[model samples]
Target: MKADETIVNGVRIGGAETKVGEDIRTIELPSGARAEVRKGYGRDLMRAQRAAANGDASAVVFALIAEVTRVDGHKIVYEDVLEMDLADVMALQAEVIDENFDRPPQRASQASSNPDSQSEH
Candidate 1:
């Protein structure tokens, strides 16, 4: 079987899968290797952001390492000693948020003006 061609429970695995969350889903490759789908990158990034905001450095680092490892398909070594740059994490979070929840660019004047109007006395 080719690297891209994988079979899981009689189903083929080629591209990335959608819908990842707390619930684990098994994916068996044609080579019989199994992988479980966990939380998505966006969700994991959000969780790390929350943890970092709450002053939990360890949580932030762990989340970052887990995210990078998952994306790079590299085995995580020295998991306990994993470190992450806060700026990089924040940038990635911003990118993900912008991509997922993008709003049309608003005119500057209209955006500055308040929606509520007051009656002149």
Candidate 2:
């Protein structure tokens, strides 16, 4: 494989997803463990959530953030982690999304509160 070329198994996703490069940052949580964060765009995040809805790919894709690996670990170096526990992933997700994990950042839909605007009731 060429150094410039990357290979990912399964899931034919990410022709455009890769365009949004990661913003790498090393964060040390209150626990003292350093996390090497690799933040991607909202599109990728939605894709992962969708995958999780379909099958086992949820824990792998969403929690680990692509690249098949174990889900459990203390030091998350972006890719070195194997299995991110519930607590760990939750905490990281908050930090990853700037604590805006409540929902993806998008324009909120406006609602007309005036009942009279509805016309003949």
Candidate 3:
């Protein structure tokens, strides 16, 4: 596999040829272990939310991590993520949440083109 590529659930992803959302991102943790995370879809988020009962926010984030993250190419459970070190967990959370949840700021021209795109803030 190329340096920019990663294998998630035994499927190869990333590289220059891949499309935007199909790319995989590699994160190196404080423990010296690397995790491969993929951009999650709506179904993945729904599954993670269901896994987190009682509407617990932290549980939902952790569940999302488990749903999209693979350490050393091995799948991990939510409990396994909870057992990780704080730094590693933060790193995982940043990568997973940013890639899946964070939206880039719209350019001035693009935002002006659509009145509905105005910032709520």
Local lDDT at 80 for model 2: 33
Best by TM-score: 3
Order of candidate numbers by lDDT, starting with the best? 3, 2, 1
Model 1 spans with C-alpha error above 4 angstroms: 1-82, 104-117
Clashing pairs in 1: 7-30
lDDT of 3 by residue, 53-82 (tens): 667999999988987888897767678899
**Model 2 bad stretches (over 4 Å):** 2-6, 9-22, 30-32, 46-82, 99-121
The TM-scores of all predictions, comma-separated, are 0.29, 0.38, 0.67
Better of 2 and 3 by TM-score: 3
lDDT of model 2 at residue 120? 81
**Residue 10 error for model 3, in Å?**
21
31 in model 3: Cα distance from truth in Å? 0.5
Q: Each candidate's root-mean-square deviation in Å? A: 12.5, 7.9, 9.7
Clashing pairs in 3: none
